[model samples]
Target: MATVLLLRHGRTTANADGTLAGRLPVPLDDVGHDQARAVGERLRRLPLAGVVSSPLRRCRQTLRRALPGAAVTVERRLTECGYGDWEGRSLSELATDPLWQDVQRRPSAVSFPAGEAMAAMAARAVAAIRDWDARITAQHGPGALWLACSHGDVIKAVLADALGLHLDGFQRIVVDPASVSAIRFTPQRPFLLALNDTGGDLRALAPPPGAADSADAPVGGGSGAR
Candidate 1:
């Protein structure tokens, strides 16, 4: 197993406009670039085994600034959930729709008209992350760390899965633009190391010597990350 950093793409033009960008090719706004660079500064302290990204433009732009010269694997499964008829619509306006209630309270059952289902989005995202985690561990050893830049809802779904929460409760998890959530996968289960972290020291995420292969939790929360 390996550690995976889940990064939501920086804010975009649609975000500032309160619109749902969905799978549209929206690029990051000016503030987003600054956020990306700041996260990059923090991430530079760790040695990332690999970097993967959603195929969407905003995600790609975020990674381009965050990792600079790092090679990025474009994963379609990490792309934004298709909002279908809701695409490019203002969130304030969508809130008035009858379907919006379902989206807010029971996302597991939400299937955007002419778009992808919420359950389906969660399935693919968790699968992609688990698969990539396995690959990174195998290629670079259990201590390896990697990153995946994706959309907000998609990342929230993945985090919900990691937290062992039902999709209906996903809205409770807020994934702000450019924030980072971390998870470490093990044979027994996945451990959520961080959630919706906007600004925090990430160096502690690197495994300590001789500890990478252990999946057991520290007894009594033995010595916090060094």
Candidate 2:
């Protein structure tokens, strides 16, 4: 029954342009850096037992700014999806391409000319979350609270698996840049405390599991498709 907080990294130059950045290793832009600082300032006071992040530059950069001194661990499995040939292309550019348009509706069947299958991305992401859960529990304790800095696609896939939600259902939930999605687990099951919470005051963003006034936490929504 550990508490897992999945944090999507801040925006990047590609993000601003609506580009697909799977395994692209793009770093945060100036705006992204500022957003990460704001996010870090917001969550600085949270009672996090440990911090973990994907090895990708974007996730790493966000973690460095947000959790300055927290014991940060690099998790390769949590890296963003591998978009293959679609790597730096914007959505609009891909729209004109038949392969891109086909994948939009039949994600499971479509793959970038050189990219990964959506199912594979979803599977790997789930595996990473399961591994992370086991690793955290083994190292910290069953009830430890931890934060994971990761990519949007990875976060969506992990949550979909953890909550037993369908991939289509996942497409209905959106994860905003630098947003925090809080999930808490008990011996019985897992619950989503909040989703896509934007910055206001980090302290007011979301409450830890078992907090008395968790009912007062803020809320936001969008399809989790990123």
Which segments of candidate 2 are over 4 A away from where they belong?
A: 200-226
RMSD (CA, Å), each prediction: 1.0, 5.7
Tens digits of per-residue lDDT, candidate 2, 1-226, equal 4567889998898998798887877889888898898888877877677788888889988988887767898887788777788788888897898876556555666666676777788887777666776677677766566788898877877777657776645665688888888776544555676678776544443333344223332357522312
Q: TM-score of the candidate numbered 1?
A: 0.97
Q: In candidate 1, what residue range of length 10 has the lowest lDDT sum?
A: 206-215
* TM-score for each predicted model, relative to the true structure: 0.97, 0.82
lDDT digits (tens) for residues 1-226 of candidate 1: 8899999988899999999999989889999999999999988889999999999999889988988899999999998898999999999999999999999999999999999999999999999999999999999998898999998899999999988999999999999999999999988788888888999998888777766677788878878667
What TM-score does candidate 2 reach?
A: 0.82
Off by over 4 Å in 1: none
